[model samples]
Target: MSRRLKNNMLTTIAYVVVLLWLFPMLYMFLSSFKFESQVAVPSLTFTPTLENYRAVVTPEFFKHLNNSVLVTAGTVAVSAILGVLGAYALVYSSLKKANNIYFWFITTIFLPAVAVITPVYIVLAKLHLLDTKLALILLNTGAGIPLMIWMCTTYFKEIPGEIVEAAKIDGCSKAGTFFKIMLPLIKNGIISSALLVFIVTWNEFFFAVTATATQSATLPVYMSKFMTQQGYFWGKMSAAGTMVVIIPILIGFFTYKSLVRGLTAGSVKG
Candidate 1:
């Protein structure tokens, strides 16, 4: 085939794949505007209504949403602060075996949440922390910090060491160099890292469901309420799902360029 024809074929395949990927989301979006009775019917001709949205937006929903926002914000804030400092240390500190320490951080990323949930639960229970936003914040921060370090380290490594040296010679304290100089250079990487942690902590379900009850449940746990003994409330669930996803979708859409750039930032390192 000619090159132009091959390109056209590839484009068609891409479009088809995108449509297939988005069809479920499109269906759910449409279904949220439907009556509970019409949701499972899978037809597009009926009139859309706001009943599902109204049902989904209860006070309980906002309470759970507030939990999610607070937990996510706390996790991201803690993770970014610690991750930046950790990455900076690994890259610039004079400590021996720093590379080994960096490797240890990378290894933590592979440790599954299930591996430690029992001990974590016990620890939280002893501290009377279960069902608390602080518990979720701490858990999600631990989960996010490793990835943040891994990502921010790349941005740090890409910077010239000489720049750090220059900062020192100019009478910049270690903290001054870190806060005033190095951080500004990697602001995009930090933003990308924080955004990622925000998304993860916001959508966290397993820890939220297991550690939290009525009070500190996040959106994912609230979404589970739809699956009651009566049956799945598809219409209301769809509406809740839409609300749960829309914020993250908007954030990802707005910061996609930074995310893409940050992910690929270290690809061409020497």
Candidate 2:
């Protein structure tokens, strides 16, 4: 085939793949505006209504939304701080077994949350932290740290050793150099990591469902209430899902450039 024809074929394939990927999200968006009676039928013939959106905006929904925001923010902040420090130490420190320590950190990421959840639950119960936002915050922060460390470490390693050496020779303390010099240079990586952590924590369901009850339930947990003995409240659930999706979408859109740059920074050594 000619090069132009091949390019056209590739573009068509890309569009098809994108539409397939977006189909479910598009369905959900359309379903959110559907009336309860029309939700049962998949056809697009029915008139759209606002009742589902209205139903999902109760005070309780707002409370759950607040809980989600708090937990996600806390998890991101804690994970970023600890991950940056840990990654820095692993890359820059002169410890004899730094590689071994880095490998150990990476191993934690492979362990499934379900495998360790029992012990975590017991510990939290003993600490009387169950059903509190703090419990979720701490759990998410710890869970997120491994990936954050991995990302930050990769980015940090890409920094030239000469820069760090220069900072040291200039009498900069390790902490000062990290905060003032290294962080600004890797700001994109940090923001990307924060966004990733926020998205993960925001949508996290297993820990939220297991560790929390009424007082600290997040948006995902709140949406679960739509399923009852009677049946699923499909319209309201769709509406809630749509609303919950907006924050992350907006964040990803606004930070798309930095996220792409940071994620791809150390991939190639050109």
Point out where model 2 deviates above 4 Å: none
What's model 1's lDDT at 60? 93
lDDT of 2 by residue, 63-92 (tens): 999999999999999999999889898888
**Pairs in steric clash, model 1:** none
Q: RMSD in Å for candidate 1, one decimal?
A: 1.9
Error of 2 at 90 (Å): 0.2
Candidate 1 Cα deviation (angstroms), residue 111:
2.0
Q: What is the C-alpha RMSD of each candidate to the true structure, in Å?
A: 1.9, 1.7
TM-score of each: 0.93, 0.95
Per-residue lDDT of 156-210 in model 1, one digit per residue for the tens? Answer: 8888889988998999998898889888888888888889889888888999999
Residue-level error in angstroms, candidate 2, position 222:
0.5
Cand. 1 TM to true fold? 0.93
Steric overlap count per candidate: 0, 0
Scanning candidate 2 in windows of ten residues, the lowest lDDT window is 261-270
